[model samples]
Target: MLPDFRVRQRDYLLEIARLLTEELDLEKLLARILKIAIEMLAGQAGLIALKETEGWRVATAHNIPPAFLSYLTPLLAEEKVADLDVTELNRMLKELTYTASMGLLNGTGIALAAHGQVIGVIFIFRNYADLFSANDKALLGSFAGQAAVAVHNARLYGQVNIEKQRLDALLDSAADGILILNADLTIERVNDAFERIFGRTHDQLAGTPHAEVIRWARDPIGVPLEEAITDGWPLTPNATLY
Candidate 1:
């Protein structure tokens, strides 16, 4: 017979799936999952650690007392369970239990996996015996799947954002003013070079109509830029004005 908490946990797991499918930002998704996990498990603390190139980073945490977070630094840093297989994952969980026992962590730990790859781990601790039941483990495994996808997507998003920042920096360093307009002719982005050349910061010009910025200085043959993009004349000569 399943406990009432187990029944509630099943419902919560469904909610986790719904959130994972709807949320785009990984951080918020993970946070929500961790909160839900802690609530379902009745744990006092929860930590989600992501496998990084160097070490496991604490991506998100909940209910962890501030004092305990500071104390578990070494355990988190030294325990790299990234390359563990299922057998190794079981061993790692045992080790986590032993490690927690020594550090006053009375909870259950779960590994997050995707395509058989261990991407991260989650730990929940409480000050009670029978900290987790079989049903709790099953529910956590289900939630871990959703959490893994969210974590993977978040890492990819972070990488893309870093690349964009690098490209923006390079553009800002250029001598010529650059203006990026959307399909609707609305200004989307401008670099520092654009600000320097036009005496206007990107923040000031952003979302403004492109025509209001340079005033359609010149067409390809030194006519009018408004005529170029509009009448298909092409703004070739105006390129040298910057």
Candidate 2:
């Protein structure tokens, strides 16, 4: 039978795995991951620092003093996770942790990596004298692996959302009528110009087939617009009455 702590660790890891797929907001995801990591390791405080173009910045922290966090941020910002000197870094971190709170005596850090790239680092601080055990490190490693993937996914999701917003803004601002279609050529979206020109709202025309909406003039191209588009028609722009 598994030890109670091992069982709890398993449960925590499973919960993190679920969050990986379901949680896409990077801030919220990092907060949850940091909280879970601290709880799992029984640490007094913990933080996840994300690498940015400028430098490493604290993405989230649990039970950490604001003063300590302010100091820690610039300290980490001096170097990338890969370029960090572990021994020297740990020494400095321990010193700072001690200064932040005399009770915090032990600290450990692990790099969070995904797809062979180091994205961030996780640091957990404890009040006890006993250093983190080898098993504890191993468990934290496994948890960090999943957490890294979640963080990477959330970043990608954020980028995609930003691009989507940009596209929506462009579509809405267009002077020419624009109709976005799905694989089946159903109306996914119609821009404001299209709605104004056709006297139909997107809400009324969405998911409607293009054939049903537009009355083409007696098969000008001798093929349906869907078939024409599918067959790579309009080699050059040609005016067609509709």
Superpose all Cα atoms of candidate 1 onto the true structure and report the RMSD in Å to 1 decimal: 5.5
Model 1 spans > 4 angstroms off: 1-7, 17-29, 62-82, 85-90, 99-106, 114-116, 184-186, 199-242
Per-candidate local distance difference test: 0.72, 0.83
Taking the tens digit of each residue's C-alpha lDDT, what string does model 2 give over 12-64? Answer: 89999999889999999999998888888889888887777776678889888
Where does candidate 2 stray beyond 4 Å? 78-92, 218-224, 229-242
Q: How many clashes in each structure? A: 0, 0
Q: Can you write out model 1's per-residue Cα lDDT over 1-242, one digit (the tens) per residue?
A: 77786778678868866876678677887788788888878887778777777666678888665665675554456645444444554455446655756755566778888777788787777766664778788888887887777677766787898899998888888888788887667789998878887888878888898778765344445545455567553445445331
Candidate 2, residue 146: Cα displacement in angstroms equals: 1.0
Pick out the ten consecutive residues of candidate 1 with the lowest summed lDDT.
Answer: 233-242
- Clash count for candidate 2 is 0
